[model samples]
Target: MGHWSRGEIERAFRDYSHAVVEIGRSSDWSRYADLFTEDAVYLEHVYGEMHGRERIREWITATMSVFPGSEMPFYRRSGTPSTTTEAGSSGRFSTA
Candidate 1:
């Protein structure tokens, strides 16, 4: 893996945020999946690991299907910083 500057990492996160918001609002997630490299690996604590962009796309699409629309906030609210921590604390996930 190559080293990335702090700015690059931050910009990537911002790009990821925008992509996620776009997917949530438009339900067109292919663009987000395209952000990943073909050989990218995605690991989720709950769903385990997936290799490659196609696999990640398939997993995310299926998992996100359980929730519809903005039931979960994928975008920033009132200019607040959008972080996974905030989303996780929003009480949107169900134990069911």
Candidate 2:
């Protein structure tokens, strides 16, 4: 693994947050696929595991189909990216 500088990590966080908000605002979960690399792997307890971006996109799109026209309201809590020096994850909150 390569070391990521603070700026790179912050930029990634901002971009990811933007993409997530876009998906929720548009109700097009497929766009979330763009956030991952072509060979990325996704694992979920309920959905099992998936490989590749397209597969993840398909799964998320299909699973999210149950909740149509749902808006995921995103909020930032606690630390901001600028102050974060280590790698971290972001989460989305949605009400279906």
**Backbone clash count, each prediction separately:** 0, 0
lDDT of 1 by residue, 9-94 (tens): 76787666666655666766566678789999988888998999999888777776667753435534464344533346563422
Model 2: residues with Cα > 4 Å off, grouped in runs: 1-3, 71-96
Task: Return the clash pairs for model 1, or none.
Answer: none
TM-score of each: 0.58, 0.69
lDDT per residue as tens, model 2, 1-96: 469987797788877776776687677888888889999999988889999999999988888787756554566546755422222243344322
lDDT (C-alpha) at residue 76 in model 1: 40
Worst 10 residues of 1 by lDDT: 87-96
| Candidate with best lDDT | 2
Question: What are the per-model C-alpha RMSD values against the true structure?
Answer: 7.0, 6.6
